[model samples]
Target: MKKFSLFGLKFMFEVKRSSKNDVELYSTSYALREKIIYLILIMFIIAFSSKIGLLSKNNNYSVGDVVISDIYAPKTIVFNDKSAKEKIIENMIAQSGKEYIYSADAGRIYLETFDEFFDDIYALKNNKDSNVDFKNLEKDTGRRIPDTMVKDLLSLKVPEIMKLQKETRKFLENLYESGIIQEKATIKYRSPFDKKIEKLSNLQRQVVETFAAPNYIYDEDKTKKAIEEKVSQINDQYIEIKAGTLVAKKGEILNERRIKILESCGVYSYKKSLGIMMANLTYLFIISTLFYQIIFNRYKKDILRKSTYRSTVLIIIAFFLTFRFINNDLIYLMPADTALFLLVLLTNTKYGLMMISFMLFFLLPIIDYDLIFLVMNIASMTFGAYLIKKVNTRAALIAVGIQMAVLKVATFGLLSFFSEVETFGAALKSGEIIVSGLVSGMIAIALLPYFEKTFNILTLFKLLELGDLSHPLLKKLSMEAPGTFHHSMMVATLSENAAAAVGANAVFARVASYYHDIGKCKRPQFYVENQQNGENPHNRVSPFMSNLIITSHTKDGAEMAKQYQIPREIRNIMYEHQGTTFLAYFYNKAKALDPTVTKEEFRYSGPKPRSKESAIIMLADSIEAAVRSLDEKTPRAIEEMLRKIINSKIEDNQLSEADLTFKEIEIIIHTFVKSLISIHHVRIKYPGQK
Candidate 1:
């Protein structure tokens, strides 16, 4: 034996040595061990792979690669766009080149150069050509310059130029050094420096104001260099995107810029979808492990022996296939409740609840984990399953549908409080929910007869139908053997109470009790119950003939049930009701005449009571007959007769095959005592009879 742990669960496999060879078997989850669920899971994967996008179309995606689908930020993304950083810095420096700055050196240089300009003009005047024409300046050989350079230069009077220099030169130089803005707005800061403004006389201020040139020059290279340095120290161009932001759309080109953004978010590729598929498949195994126990508790013994498995597969196919074709929004209209009721009717509530568990798993991937819709449907489905447990009429199914619809409406209303939609919209959606809920029960009842006939499920509705006195066989029994019919009804009534007390199917007990003696209709006059004139056919017949006539009723009832197309469950009850209880009167008479008489020869054919309901019918039938024969109509007499008859059954091993506890038998005895006492209560003696 080898034990290993996988997926948080331990599995053990025993390697057995056969005579031929050693064989190794792998241990796996129930879903895999049971090929049915494994096949269903395969179908699930194949059918919904594309819908849920479980398989990856393309996994190996890189930067600048376009995606096949929209990707979203799984978490907050914060990253610098490295590709856009350099270009952004370059643009910032180019814009900074236009700014002006104060340059005192350039201002002083201009003043000195102006004085040299005066020296050149005087030297020209001192030359032989004292009347130097400005027009001829363009052709001058030694130091030719543009006329604009000296446009104001030639206009200045000789003494005036010296005077201009004397008054403004000192102040203008200081002003330029202090800084004159060509554009005041270009200055980086508005706060003045600590230096005081130079005091100027009226004439000094006038000359300086009139003659000051803009010395605040823009050094493009210096400004560009400064900007480059400042921007280099600045932080990287980082972007912060909130969670769930759309990172990219399908087929969108993901350049380096977008790629950097994608890197900050969670990893996304087509391969992730493949991981989803694997994870969901594992979850399906978990779901199966959780439910298959209760669903198959009595699997082969009960409804599964019928067509329960086939019906289960059919429901699964119908649900998944319908969702595959119809709009997912219309999933509410699929009548899942009908499937749930069918399962409950065919098996039991616990099995139906187990199926609901399976349905929950089926719903997860189909609804894409829409919890609201999931809750709404599961609640309504469970409610309808429990509803059908007690109701036994076709008309009552309409009431069940109404109750389920009310449940759905209530669920939707509670859920709507969170969304708070408009009145009309909420009402409309609620109406839709109501319709969806009602569709389940309405359709279930409509197809119930077909399900019963096809699946061989004996539902409470079917049982009630069979118990009706108006049925042809039942009507014939009442007419031909009124006493037998009355006896059967009493047994049914008493058996129903006992079955209910013992937690058995009371409806089955009652319905089966009604038909347990239908064979007596064939030999009504031979039985004591229908011997209207107290005639004793047994007195006329030999003991062997009487035993044969009386013991044949069990098989006779079974045969009659088949002839009338009764459900096998009811037919089995008729055969097992008598078990092999010895007919003491006939057997004793036979032994008196012939010394070789055997108990088995006088006993009914012995299948014995194999179910709680059948065991209950056996006890109820015997007790009712014994209580009827008691001369004293008293509670003490009825109790003694019930205990004596029930004890006789117990001593004879009549209930050995039944699944009844001692406590359940006690409860059945107590219930029978109360019911029999009420049935045989002392009546008023008639005037002449006393």
Candidate 2:
């Protein structure tokens, strides 16, 4: 008997090991499938973003081609011709003339000469020589004078000559100081002693003429610099092409101005089409590769599903097309934040931020590399995503929208402060940005339900809605199977605590647990929790039949969840909670009746718990049911029971597929023990107790 028991034990151990291996294999296959799906989705997005404009017939138009208006400008957009502006500015600079710079040194030279001449006059006057020499005066004055004129000057008294010299010096000083001594300046003088100005001798006229000199010197360097500075101060000139103006007629040849207008309106030339196509393809490849690398490194699990990645790609594509088709003036109102909001709702904040950044890069060329538009939209989208990240109510979206608008306005103002462009029409642009943010938020809020339904995504709002106990399915379960409902509530409590302790999704666990036992409502009388008045249904049914009834609950619950349109994640937990675990009581009874009965016959049909949340539900469900049946309700007994139940699941390899570490499992155990103690805690009876 001992040898036979050993053989049986070994056989059972092998079977359990094989079952664990199967779970691992299935998990690996599922993960591989998810990765493949994600790869295909990424490829599709890359192809879509890259080939968007390349395939269009209009993209083939060249500079020489005659084109008609397929689409008209929606408003009177006044586009500044960049090339024309550059040319106009250059012409303005070229036409500016050099300026003449005046110098004070010429005036100083004139004054010094007058003072020296006056000193000479005083020297001759104070000398008191018996005879004044006219020849010596002529030499000192540095001028040739006629002999007759010199003799005539000598004939005058010393006081008369001194007075004449003083008068001449004063006249020359005034002339130089007045800045009239230019290149063509001339000086004519008349002595106070001469009765007629025309009667003055040639020698006297020569003396006065020698003092007249050009004071102003031409400064080539200073003139050139002054002209350059004046030119630099002139603002850039632009050629404004008003909307509704015919840039080109049907047969008119396209000039540079018309070409600029066409380019501004998003018409491209086919002359460089190949180069443009290559550049766009290269950019798309680089961005797509980087995006994939980031997702693989940081958000592998979050975007592993096709639906999640596809939804994000679709949002980006939708926005891209919207911008492509809309009028340039209204481009700001394209609802950029809508993509970010959906991304946050679908994936997470980090992924949403990364995707939006990539989107900005893609939009740069399309928007004519407008940094203001790029920065404003990026800031608004980021703020919107952050504001709504933790919000769980639809009403909160309005507040987020308002806050996003305020943030966009502030962002626009800050950007405008640093902008080099004139702020003449900034009020209208600011209004546009504000409207864009507000309208974008409203649109996002309006379309959120549609996106959630279409993608079958479980956002925070959806999770909250599912958590409501008054939900139709939960209410039905409550009325049909009160015992199972109570059990579900207990499991939900346990799972929530354990999930929190292990740093898992607590709300997801709670909501999933609330609906995990809905299948029991179909036949509540068969379950032990719903058994009435000392009656056991298992007594009348065979173990095989009982196992079938028990095992069918997981499949039934999944179908019921589907009927109510529950999210796939929650339905998955319902289907995976049992995790191929055997109905131990029925299995034991069957083995007692017939020793040939196999443990596999009592096991639930399961692909095993494939996530932390599902695994947590599995553990909580078993613990709650086991603890409820314990007669000896003490802290020590409950702790021991919890350990044994956890150990059994571990040995059975039910949790092999879950991404839980040993440390997390230990934390879960501690949490479960504490919660069970509180639930089964003994209370002291007062004196008036029955």
Candidate 3:
């Protein structure tokens, strides 16, 4: 036995050369007709969404447009007159009186003034030493008192002066209590003792005048606050515009109010132009035709073979319907990136870009051709398609979404900056755009699994999940048929390397290879890879019976894949990997036993590999088994044997259906040989006999 390693998987058995070719690509007249039908259906969906309300005309009149007729509202409409309401509220507020809040210490100020006046008078009456001086008495009282009055008061007896002071204090206190003596108010007091004081000369009169002082202080702040509170109490008033009312007369320039009323009434006459409609339709037709041509010419093979084409159309229509029925400013929140992401995931980046273009061309009219919206959408789609090339994990998908959001925000910012609208409104619009981008990404990511499951499509994320060795079927295979499991792993490694070299889906190739031999688990003893004992099962059966058992694995694998709810692409590979090639040993054995046996009877029933990944897996599956079977494990011998196997497959028409050019095939062969050489390298021996 010879030992060899390929992509780090060690093998110690003779290689089994498979005679099956890669699956063939099929496109019949019915498939072509179906493509046409799907295209037409997609066109109708676009047209229906586009042409809705096409007959309704938009008013193009601005401020200068003269009203020819007295346009009235068709229905009773209650329009908000914001300006009028604001003006009314402002006027009411201006006319309203202010509220006044009295100071908490105002009473204390009055009390202090009264106390000072009484103390000065009482001190003068008693002839006691006091701080009140006659010369400065006017300053303290805020009024002038005669010098003669002070001299006369001091000359009087204590009892007479005391009685006069008591009477004066009582009169002043009464005046203060009357609320007439405000802190800033002037009071002229004519005392009841004025008649009596007339005999005492001008002294008493001067004292009375001096005693009268302003008591009430004006509070400017409090008064102003009161007025403000009154103003704030006024409510906004509305003006109703009645139906059948003349919003604007002929030759009357439209003011803001008149314009608002006219808009509210839905009053405007639009010129019906057939030429414009025809031009729009022509534009739609040209763009739609170009879109159809792009898909038909570029992705015809991928689309025609399955429901992917229909699914694409359906996805587009779903978006169209969303735009049609859900009328709102939030139409920007439509996950346009979702379509781009799906297109990139399902087909390629080129198709994704084309989808963005198609969506913009068709949806712009529906969105009223907003240039800012178009720019943002384009930026979002472009980044989403480019960034989400291969989403193997949910986290990677989220990261792609974040990238799209950042790009969208940047695009919106640029648009806002160039528009020269630097107001808060522009900032708010930018925020909305950013939010829409983020929401779009989330929706796209959230809907990815559903889309994959619904369309029976194999996304890279789905492939990763299926590729996990922990999966129930894979685990079962590993436990039940350990040798076969190892063989599948080796085949997957080879397929993945070849796929990457040829620029194919390496993940899909690897995942498909993993479950390709699952059917062998059903009859582990019959397959040589799983046979533990040296007894060959084929020795006990006829060549035809052995051939039947061998060929049935492909069918059985497909059935098991379906039972496990595996994706259609993987199931397809399982069915087509062995591509109706002759089982040489069994066919030859049968021919030796009976000369009339047909070659087809000993062949594996297969539809053949249809895609590049499937074809790569088919080659890898055969190559891995064959390389393992070789007795000569030298690098050069292995390379020569690999080339012979490839050449044999090509010569046998096994690679005919594979979409592989000669250049790509060469690269794949080189990659395979390099990987095998690394695995089969000769080890240095120390003092050992050859």
Candidate 4:
């Protein structure tokens, strides 16, 4: 029977050990976890890219309608239906040689130079005595020389009048060269393009009513040769089109069909528009990188712990893709603040700044104009993040509301610069943006508890809050079982020191200390600390019952911790702080009475402390309780107590499963003994002290 029992116990022991191993094995499958995150990120990028048509090629064309006219007027003037040509000619005539036009009847006039005018009346005719004043004639003409005449004359576009002037100049030069009029000859015309031929007979110089080729003009043969010669130069000025493709027409609309062809030819369809968007995207990336480096990167681990890169990537992709359906407004929701708050609960200022920067990047392609609003959004998020960073309780939800207000005001201020918009409208948009941030932040806050429960990412800040001395359970322990509470507090001090010395979580140790004795509150009188009236309940109970009561704290504490939704990390410590060990004091007392009491019946069943902090607390609790019994609270007594406790725990195989090394244990023991002796040492008394 004994051999069969031993075999059965060994089998049960193996099963328990295997179960604990399984728990730890699955807790750290880091490689598979990271792969899953990356896969999700890629899927999100693809979805967003497709949504915005970012994967598809697009193009644009510029076109305008032009009219044909033969009047040879400036395009601007023709379009406006203004007589700019006549105005220009009139201005030119004012600055012409005095002899060019004399007395004019409506549009027709006689012309002569200043010298000719002088000679005909004052010099040659010698009518100077007859008041033939040239100055009077010039004043009577009412035409003044203008400063811009030369420029207007050069720019004049009357092709026919220009031809006439050339012909007249040729005729006069020929007349003088052939000695037809030996004296210097001069040609006259109503205007530069309307020359009056003097030597040609009326028949030869007939003014053709219809457009006609001048006799001196080139014939078809010569004209064709001249056209061919100019073709090369003209061709260079025209837009070249390949032989098979149709040339683009002016004012043509680039419909879908045309755009497709253009894209196929490696042409940029949107012309310059794509360049601007790409530039904005690039700028956004730069700004985001800078902001993230400065603000978000510092707290990267903490932020990413909750806001996984996979989720951020997915949200960014979703926001980017939304650009196809809409623009600026939608993109604003994708930035660092939104992503951080949505994906993670920590709304720190650093994260807010990073989120804003990221939002700017996402907004680049979506916000076609007015970048100031994006800046405002960023500022608001930064403020919100700062407000929520230090929130340790659920009331931190107020920070979210405050953040919304900041966003609204900042956004309104930014939008005000561009237009005198209605304050209500600005206020409304601001409110919307703020609300979004708050909603997202609230969601994050709600998830925080679940995340902590599922993942044992116990932060110090959270542990400190959980360990508050005034917490209901701790208060109960203090009031009902003050002895146990005081013992727990001493254990907390020793365990905290030991944990820190071993480079473990001291806060976890301290928190575990408070709740480690919580089970004693159920039967406070049975424990010595709460037996103030000196009625020892254990004296009347069987040794087995006493052991059951003492050991049941682990079970009771575990139940209470679960009921309160205490995190698994804290709960685990409570379960493991005191590994199954013999309660020798009560067991010895029972053994003296019956001499047959089983030691097994006097031991508390345990899970054994799994983590370094829990293990340290267990040792500290035992050592502190043992050292308190010393007649003299000396350094040697404390040191011996610590050594015995540690050695006993090791001998019982309690510390074997823990991660703490021998080196760390040694350090912990030294630090704990020193601290304990310091606390208990007697200070030198004054002169009268005995």
In order of appearance, the predictions have TM-scores of 0.64, 0.73, 0.63, 0.47
Ranking of all candidate structures by their TM-score, best first: 2, 1, 3, 4
* Top model number, TM-score: 2
What lDDT would candidate 4 get against the real structure? 0.56
lDDT of each: 0.70, 0.72, 0.70, 0.56
Question: Per-residue error at 438 for model 4, in Å?
Answer: 11
lDDT of 4 by residue, 1-690 (tens): 122356446422322333446555555344334443453344334332422432234323433212111111111100111234344444544543232112123211112232233233223233345543344434644443232432233344446335544554455334222222111233223332244344444422432111111212113455445444544333111121232344334445555434433333323335444664466555554554464454343644534454444444455565455554553334334333444454334233454455445544444444443465556655665656556545556556546645655665666666664554445555555666666555655655555555455554454345766788878888888888889999999999988888878878676788888888787778889877678667898889876678788888888888887787666677777778887777898788788888888877776677887788878888887888888788888887778777887898999888877898989999998988888887788888878756
Candidate 3 Cα lDDT to native? 0.70
Which scores greater on lDDT, model 1 or model 2? 2
Q: Per-residue CA lDDT of candidate 3, range 1-22, in tens?
A: 7798999999897767655333
lDDT of 1 by residue, 1-690 (tens): 899999999999999765422232332233223635543564465345524543334332566677888887654434566666788777776665455666656566556654554566665634645554543322322234444534454466768656756655765555665666565335321214113223554434433443345657667677667886878786666565766788878898777667656645534344654576677767666665555554445343433353666666666666666655654445555666776777777667776666655676666766555566678777876777777776777767767877887887788778867754345545765777677666777787877788788777678788888978898889989999899999999999999998887778888888899999988887888888899667788888999998887888878888988888788888888889999889888888889999897888988887899999999999988988878888996877777777888888889999999998989988988898899888878787878754
Largest lDDT belongs to which candidate? Answer: 2
Please give the lDDT score at residue 17 for candidate 1. Answer: 68
